[model samples]
Target: MHIHKKLVSLITLSLVLLNTTACSQRIGALNDTLKLAFIGDKDVKLSTQQVNDIPYASIYAQIGDMSQVFIVLVFAEPKVSLTQVPTTLSTELKWLSADKGMIVTVNGRLVRTHNNPTGDLVAVESTEPDPIMLGLQLASTPKTWTRIIDWQPGYHFGYRATSYFNLVGQEKILINDIPTQALHYSETVLVDDLNIQYQNEFWLTPETGNVIKSRQKIAPNLPFIDISLLKPFAS
Candidate 1:
């Protein structure tokens, strides 16, 4: 009974080609099964002296498909020593509207309550969970990948350079231990130079027709620290 309840709590869904990671079946033998990938988190060190590498956390998710959402969380922990004062580790939630207008009731509150000019973020339900899991439900959905059209480059869409806004075929990444191809497109949300961008790597799963992995920089604009796929929250 306890095990069954645990299973009930788990959010079940398929992943699109994906976030910190994606879950998909292989081509032939494993094409019909749903493979789940859970990544863990790493420590982050923030510094004001670095060029663009700002303080950030690694990312991990539990991607899902269909009528799902991309839940993401952030964290930063220091591993050097017990004395290495760690940065305030947490997830800065950036919930988006299903449409392009506004996220009506995010976590229950009106979009205007949490949306601000610079950063008027409001806590929905703050708890230390897996950032990747938060995103998995949405990541599993092929829609998640398609939402970013620039990434559809025949094979796979991802980051292949230092700055995705202008370059490609340079930055490389590993997915499930294999080399994959990627595209680049850095968007400036705020100002031109003061924009946000990332270095990304994507892996597509033909089995599920969704993305499998997405390794991105913490910040696409300012080179902050990076977050890789690790694990997900107890859905």
Candidate 2:
């Protein structure tokens, strides 16, 4: 039976999170301090109380365009040439707590309720996670680097912190009241048995020091996961 793309994608994305977030601080950058995160620009004012008094649960954060997009894409696009989505101040995404499990909803509609082992706890609006379909069944898979590029601090950049499907990720960052850069990161993991690789790019606003947007793509030609931040209001 042919599986629906949505289900496949979400499952894959789910698996990706499991492998990517489990690394400890000593293992690599996947730590509480330097987590593989995409917090928004530090310059913007954020609404941190949409759910509990503490910054918990998923959020519909609004991404302001006043900031700038990361520059890693400019350096790596020539090699991967994946999609580069725009950076909107406010977009569609379930912002979860930096730690612990989170429940997501929009306009009072349930979205997702899962805990990211890496500390990020939110899910997209029915988009398939990007690993199950790509054959990232285990985190101890072999991998290769298609290209190496430099990313100016603040924008996004992709690097292999592990051997799993190389992670192609990004982040939008704003430092100290200015749209400093976009923190983009991506890693392409290679599982020999599957013969497929993953290329993902995330867009986040450093102004808020949180991931405002994220996108992912599979090899040979497949649709990518596009996520953006939505404005959070009193619930």
**Which of the numbered candidates is closest to the native, going by highest lDDT?**
2
Going through the candidates in the order shown, the clash numbers are: 41, 75
- The residue-by-residue lDDT of candidate 2 on 35-132, one tens digit each, is 21223433223232311222212222222222321110000011111322222112222333332224333322222334422222122211222232
Candidate 1 off by > 4 Å: 1-6, 11-164, 191-235
The TM-score of predicted model 1 comes to 0.23
Q: Which candidate is the best by TM-score?
A: 2
lDDT of 1 at 165: 23
Please list the residue runs of candidate 2 whose C-alpha ends up more than 4 Å from where it truly belongs after superposition.
1-180, 205-209, 218-222, 232-235
Candidate 1: 10-residue stretch with minimal lDDT: 144-153
